[model samples]
Each structure stands twice: as structure tokens, then as C-alpha cells.
Target: MSKLPLDPDVADVAPTDSALTPYDNQHIVTYARLLQAESEGADWREVARIVLHIDPDHEPDRAQNAYLSHLARAKWVTGQGRLLRGAGSN
Candidate 1:
């Protein structure tokens, strides 16, 4: 896999591939961040702005879709044995 980006350029909607993609590899950190944010009870709007970089205020539907899809992929990845890059490991 190519070196994972520290910050990925997010799609309007994250990939729909059930299997992992290059996008998945590049976004492992983003996935982890999303899961962490959700677990912390962060608001979807705030998480969307911070993690996905989509302004929910301007585009609520797009932001929500990106947030949910990426979050789902994150859960799937962890369940399928992809290691998270660990908190604060950088």
C-alpha cells in the first residue's frame, strides 16, 4: 500500500465497495477518527466538520452521508481484522 496520508481528500460519499479499496487504506486514520468521535458522543455535525471536512451547515445531506458511510466502513474494517494506527502513535 502507498504511504497513508496524514489527511485524506474525502469524497462527497465514501466508496461503496464492501471490500477494501486504496481509498480504504488511505483513510484508515480517518476511519479510526470517526469511530472515536462517535464513541465520544460527538455531534454528527461537529464530527462531519472536523473529520470529514464537510460543512454540515451548508450541506447537511452530503455531510451526513459521508459521515455514515465512512463510519460504517471503519466498523467493517476493524471487524475484518485491519489494525487501527493506534491513538497518538504518530
Candidate 2:
């Protein structure tokens, strides 16, 4: 079986908070999923469990916060952060 890219040990598989930080190339797919979920109005708890592997049942606050933080970072990347990374010119 092929390994999934969602390994927690792999740093760039998730979004970071810094607007100055270059977007992690590896998180492209993850960002797509987050955007899709946002568009579809999916619940953050479910997204946290499924996409981010965070169990809201076990750690509700942490899961909710992680989901919101990552989603916000994803949105930033697709918006202003993209400009910072020169996404359109490519």
C-alpha cells in the first residue's frame, strides 16, 4: 500500500500560521480539501477528525482550534498569501 502524505511527523503536511512563511508545497492537496470543505459548509469537527486526524471527541477544544487555525491559514494562502508566494504570475 502506498503511504499517505498525512504523516504527523512530516512537518509541511499541515499549514503554519506565519504569513511570511512560504506556503508548504506538500500541503497543496490538504489545502484543497480544506477549501472544498469550507465551500461545502462541512463541520469543523468532522474536518478536524477526517482531514487533520484530530479527534474532537477526545480533545474537543484542541480539535476545534486546530481546525479553525489550519483553515484560516489555508484561506490566507489562497488569498493574500498566494500573492506573497507569487502564485498568479506562474
Candidate 3:
């Protein structure tokens, strides 16, 4: 499967500073959206549609999983991604 679910060009995974991945560099907006959703206590289904572009009602498992996975990666980027701020900078 592609590293990014919706947009292949936008990376969705995160690696280390020295070992940078495309997802780590391209998913900044997505990561920010996840953080904002968490802060606002938004629903996962809603977040999936708005952020990941996955419809939870149509594909429950895929949508939920994408939301959760992206959110987790986003959180990781927020913490670890900052370490490489000057370089990849999420």
C-alpha cells in the first residue's frame, strides 16, 4: 500500500531525523489537522472525512483505521518530528 492513503504525493508516515521519509516531510498539514481535531474533541469520523477524505459511513473500517493511524503518526510527528524541525520540520 502507499505510504499516504489519499494523496500519494503527500507522505503520511514519520521516520527519524537522519532517516527522513517523504511522509514525514509532506504530511505537515495533515498532522496539524489531527492536532486541531484532538484539541477540539472532534469525532473521528468527521476528522476522517475532513482531514483524510475517507468517509466513515461508507467504509467504516478503512475510514476509522485511517483516522486513527494518521492521528497517531501526527502525534508522533508533533513530538519526534520537532527534533528534526530545522531539517524536515514535519
Candidate 4:
């Protein structure tokens, strides 16, 4: 698996008064699942679209860009997975 990009600022800030918002956590989890399901295959553009859908008002920050790049790289390495699995699979 490719190394996930980390935002230095995110770590720089103290967590005592900081916590990921529900939306943030949701995006993170969705991204992780997308990455894992595709075996690290995820397109940055598609990921960006997903991110935008999650937070339309929020601008694409540095961390977001980094993540998109990472996803693109992963997608390049591995192909996107099947939308549907075997028969009877939900």
C-alpha cells in the first residue's frame, strides 16, 4: 500500500481542544474504505469529487490536495475494483 499523506499542521495542533468533525471522520473512513477495497486503487479526481460532495463549502486545502495525489497514485498502481461482487453479493 502507498504511504498516506499526512498534514503537518494537523499534527502540529494540539488535540486537547481538537477533534475530527463527524464529516471529517466520515470522509476519512470513506477514503480508507475506497482505498482498501481497490487494494490502494483510487483516482484522485474521483476522490476530489467525493470530497467536494462531502464538504461543498470547504475549499480544497493542502491536506486535501495531498490526499488526492495519494489516491491518484494508488489508482495508478492498482485498478479500480468491481462495483458488484459475486452472485447474490450485496
Tell me, by TM-score, which candidate is best: 1
Rank order (by lDDT, best first): 1, 3, 2, 4
Window of ten residues with lowest summed lDDT in model 2: 4-13
Residue 62 lDDT, candidate 1, scale 0-100 = 95
Compared with the true structure, the alpha-carbon lDDT of candidate 2 equals 0.64
Comparing 1 and 2 by TM-score, which wins?
Answer: 1
Per-prediction TM-score, please? 0.85, 0.66, 0.71, 0.26
Local distance difference test values of all predictions, in order: 0.82, 0.64, 0.65, 0.37
Q: Which one wins by lDDT: 2 or 3? A: 3
Residue-level lDDT for 20 in candidate 3: 42
Model 3 stretches astray by more than 4 angstroms: 1-19, 81-90
Whole-model alpha-carbon lDDT for candidate 3: 0.65
TM-score of 3: 0.71
Q: Write the per-residue lDDT of candidate 3 for residues 1-90, one digit (tens) a residue.
A: 333443433223334344445655566667777888899999888988777877789888888767777777777666665524632454
The digit string of per-residue lDDT tens for model 1 on 1-90 reads 346687786898777776767777778889888888989999999999998999999999999999998888888877767735542232
For all candidates, the clash counts are 0, 0, 1, 0
What number of backbone clashes does candidate 3 have, counting pairs of residues 3 or more apart or in separate chains?
Answer: 1
In candidate 1, the residue pairs with backbone N, CA or C atoms under 3 Å apart (3 or more residues apart, or in different chains) clash, namely none
Measured with C-alpha atoms, the lDDT of residue 18 in candidate 1 is 69
The RMSD of every model to the true structure, in order and in angstroms, is 4.2, 5.4, 5.9, 12.8
Error in Å for residue 1 of model 1:
8.4
